[model samples]
Target chain A: MNLEDYKGIWIFVEYTEDKISELTFELLGIGRRLADKLKVELSSVILGHNIKCDLNLLFHYGSDKIYKLDNKHLEVYRTIPFTDALEYLVNKYRPEVLILPATSIGKDLAPRLACRLETGLSADCTELDIGPDGNLIQKKPSYSENDYITILTPNHRPQMITIRSKIFTPQTPDPNRTGKIIEEHLELNESENWTKILEIIEEDQEDANIQEAEIIVSVGRGIKKPENLGLIKKLSSCINASIGASRSIVDLGWISHYHQVGLTGKTVKPKIYIACGISGAVHHIIGMKSSDFIIAINKDPEAPIFQVADIGIIGDLFEIIPILIDKLTIK
Target chain B: MKIIVCIKQVPETNNIDFNPSDLTINRSHVNGIINPFDLNAIEEAVRIKEKFDDVTISVISMGPPSFEKTLKEALTYGLDSAYLISDKLFAGSDTFSTAYILAESIKAIGDFDLILCGKHAIDGETGQVGSEIAENLKIPQATNVKKIEFHENKKIIKVESDTENGYRVLEVKLPALITVNKEINVPRIPSFKDARKALKIPIIKWDLGKLKNIDKTKIGLTGSPTKVVNIEKFQKKKDTKFISGTPNEIVNELYQILKDKHVV
Candidate 1:
């Protein structure tokens, strides 16, 4: 656990369909800050078969160094081979801190990597900082869900923290900035690996990535009946925005779990997020608090949602939605 | 196939009370229930058992002896067996230490094909223990699973991982570990027949000496790298600004406030 043994900050650069995940860039922004604070270099570990586009983008996002392990076996993400590759890098060059996006791949891969390294990892962290004593402090909401608990990895060689996407804004890429590239060879036998990616069933592209949507129209328990959701859908279509909901709505089977936005749900950072009849429980707030604009429409002005909302409306959503829809149609 | 589901007894959030003086939670007044996320994992495990008649499902938990009550509740779901790992020596364990003890206990129990866990515990919310356990056992693992399919002949397991944007379908060998999200499945309530059977069954409890290759340093607070240096009761701000207007007027006024806040 010697501090000098670990050299720099590293971000796991994840990609899909030969495209860089937005979370990769977001991690770079956060990694840059942590690296600057700790006075260490910021690096990225890119694993893919052919990631020419992704490699170029990593330099743009401020990676001081890139560790590329390009191979046919690394084409799709699986547990064993991917973990083996990452474990190799972490062992070879110990990092002072590692930041990963709390996405499905990141969540699955981060914990496995931490365990292999026999180190400490903090997951779904909303805030990360360096303590005066030079320890990595990861802060997240605790039991009550109202307050945050700041955690520090005191004895671990490389403190790992996974940040949920959309919690931090991505910084602008500087084309002028450049860094060195370090290539790592994959040594594991593909046949011996435990997991294999069978097939990639591509979902419809028309479906919006709720976490990345600029405008979102979210429904809650106040919708009353499932049929009334058409109004929300109509509004969403009119505005060309995606539809989201609180956990209550999802739990009630009013919508699929994919539409859920909250603590246990997807954390959306939409430019404009409208809450229709949502009471805004703390569990729900953790997901959408990062949204750039929040408009809460609830019958109860006392609802917790109003506290964090930029606009708080006190009236029935049924009455207001129609009028707003009519106004928008005319405009 | 023998599936081992690791569950925890957590304080129901609704019943939790805050201690202002020390900023600690008062657990005495709160009722404990199986962690909600673990319930989903247990349900999935039961579904797998039903698919394979020879499958044996065991529910395991590590906590105070009274936490064995949760094992009885698990029996109501038709679990084949239950085990409780309780010892005062394992108190105040963080994820690192907790995983070590659980892994050791799992090895002692033997005959395990798959291990299931909730993606994260509500009490700790760290989501590290399941991975830690898999690491300790040297098994492949996956988290945030939305769907699971088993290939009995090939001994391969396919899991759909719920990513932030979409899903990643992964096929892994058996004798693996998985942590499921609540979205995976709906848990069923126990029937009267199963409930009666559960009441008759006794949980097998174990102490530190019962586990093999026990690492004392990695079983408690000593093995933990992170500590809760401080915990303060959270207090919400008491400021409330009330505005009076007709529906249309209020909408207009709210719109103005939203504009000022750049929320529109």
Candidate 2:
């Protein structure tokens, strides 16, 4: 475990619907900054089956080089195969820091990879930087959104961290930029995988995911009855917004957990977030506070949600929402 | 069927304040509750035990001795036995060290058919311990699991893991680990009789010495590679513009604001 053996920063490149994931692009933005600070190269590692994309986008996004491994076993997102391939790469070409998105695929792969490498992996990091002593400084929100703790893997090589998407803005891609592509070969035995994928069910597009929604109309216990969701629907329809919910309503079975916006649910950052009848608990606030513009309608003037809202209206949502919908519908 | 469920007791509320001087959570007035997701894991394990024959469920946790109270409460959910690994030396362990302690304890317990854990603890929210344990034990793992079904031979498990867009069904071999998500099932409330019975059940306590061949450096803070350098209060802009008046007036003002922002 010689720290000197690790020299560069690497970001795990992920794909969604054949294109590089937005999160992976975002990682390159931060990875570029960190690599520049350490005076080391920033590389993107892609492991997939028959990846057809030129992967010039990695360089355009900010990668100095690309390490790719293409094999039939690496096609689908399986924990064992992905972990084995990554373990091979990290050992063959040691990286000082490895970053990944805290998305479903990344969360599943990073921890297992960390265990195999016996290194430290910080989870859902909100901030990453180079410390004074040249260690990767990982900052993440603790139990409470109000408190953030900075962590450092002082004794580990190839420090690892998983960051949630939308924390950093992706840089504009420069098509002129190109990087050295290093295609790596790994012999993976299919028999090593103890788990087999049976099927992948893509959700029907009946509703946009709140995380991807441009505008969100989120509700809470203040909405009262289940039937009152009609009011929220009316408002959302008028504004072309996706419906989001606080954990309380989601837990009460008023809405699907997919629409939940909070600590246990989804972290959403939309263009405009309208919180109706929500008290704005720290849990709920952490999810939507990052939205570009936040408007809160709550009867309680002291509701914590108001603390983050740009525009706060202390009124009954039942009365306020209908009129607001009418005004928007009229437009 | 032998099932091991890993659970954690966390602060009841996420509104914990930070002690800037020592960079620590101000836990002076906070009470602990079973991590909410772990309750789902406990309920799922209990449901499986009821659905099958010869299914013995054992719960494990690592924390302060105060966690024993939580383990006892888990038994009220119809789990068969409980184990708590607590030691002063294990304090301040990060996820890696914490996983090592739990994995070592699981190894000492010998053979088991399945391991279940909450997707992540609410307090730390690392979501790593479950997967790390599987790696340490060199077993297959399915995380963010929403549903699970057993094969007729009872040697393989098919699980639906939540993905970003939808779900993926995976078939994992026996002796695998699965971390349950809150969407899996609703936890059932125990009756007074169950509580009384749970009180009568004895809990097996383990210290650092209880884990055989355990590396002392990897079991606690000293073994931990990561260190908390600082704790700071999150700052956000508090310049909220309050709109007052009748419902109509407020809506008109809000609509005007929205129109100004070109949102309408």
Instruction: Please report the candidate that would top TM-score against the real structure.
Output: 2
Candidate 2 chain A lowest-lDDT run of ten? A140-149
- Listed in order, the DockQ scores are 0.43, 0.62
Off by over 4 Å in 2: B14-29
Docking class of 1: acceptable
Scored by TM against the true chain B, the candidates give 0.90, 0.92
lDDT of 2 by residue, B116-146 (tens): 9999998778899999999999999999999
| Over 4 Å off, model 1 | A191-193, A205-208, B13-30, B152-154, B232-243, B255-264
Q: Given candidate 1, what's the lDDT at residue A16?
A: 71
* Global lDDT of each candidate: 0.80, 0.88
What value does the lDDT take at residue B102 in candidate 2? Answer: 93
